[model samples]
Target: MAEIDPDAKRRPASVKELKAMSHPLRVRIIRLCGDHELTNKQLADRLGVDPGTVYYHVRQLVDAGFLEPAEVRTGESGALEKPYRSTGRSWWLSVQLEDLDTSQGFAPVEAFQQELAEAGPASIASYARFALHLSPEDVAELDRRIVAVIDEYVETDTERAHLPAHGGIFLLHRTPD
Candidate 1:
């Protein structure tokens, strides 16, 4: 088993950053940039939006440290274009669950919807759902284990070059009896 990267740091995102990412478009933009670098114009074209809108969102993401400047290249119009890429770090936020239920709550679902629309339902290879009861300690341990597994895959650098972009989400919560 590989150990966690010593240099890898997981810091809680600031409120400003979280607010910036609360928008579904921003979430989709981050997901789109996950595997490869892209310019605002490319992202705009992919989402069928204007370059100005993409530029605004890209600037917000870049300012939040979720995206970084990748390169500058000439576009089809022979003008220089700036590209950006995801930082490849999962954000850690300590907000109360109630807070997330606000505007940020549906962002992930929207992002998933956008991806499904792009890839089509036929592209999905696997899907599963489960519900289980456990003690508080067990719940904590289970969460840790699941996160470790996800982190292992998330940190894959070399192999990711050949792999396509994928998204996975795990939601755990206890319901009142």
Candidate 2:
């Protein structure tokens, strides 16, 4: 197991940074860039949005330090294109959804939903569903344990970058009556 540095801490997102990331499109942009560097035109094509619109959101992410310009490279058509890559800064920023507007707070979740749908059911590797009843303390402990496990994997993700990327979301919510 990789030892995590105890002194390392995730900083809370500032108002400006949080606002910059409060859009679902921006969240998707970050996720896509994480996989590889992408040019604005490529992003616009993959997202089925106007290049101008992606450029606007990309500018916002770059300003917020969530994305950075990568080395300029020649494309297949021998045209120079500037690509952007995710800075991975957002992974280290703690966002408190309660501090944001309801719609803004749901941006990440909405982005995940969209990505999952795009990936399709065949992409699902594993899944489980269950309901648990617990007191506040138990709930906190459960959350802590689950996060610790996930943190271990996240801390060492770069080691497995060559492997195919897998996405998962662990959501705990009240069961509807």
Candidate 2 lDDT tens digits, 1-177? 654442255778899899888998999999899999999999999999999999999999999999999999999999999999999888777666568998887788898899899899999999999889988798767766676677778878999999999987776766788
Write model 1 residue lDDT over 1-177, tens digit each, in one string: 864532244555567777777888998888788766899988999989999999999999888888899878888899998899988543443334455656787787787788788888888878877778899899867766776677677656557667665676677777777
Candidate 2 residue-pair clash tally: 0
lDDT of each: 0.76, 0.87
Cα lDDT over the full model 1 = 0.76
For model 2, the run of ten residues with the poorest summed lDDT:
1-10
Local error of candidate 1 at 89, Å?
3.5
Q: What lDDT score is found at residue 62 in candidate 1? A: 88
Deviation in Å, model 2, residue 10 alpha carbon: 1.1
Per-residue lDDT of 156 in model 1: 68
Residue ranges of candidate 2 with Cα displaced over 4 Å: 1-8
Which pairs of residues clash in candidate 1, taking residues 3 or more apart in a chain or in different chains?
A: none
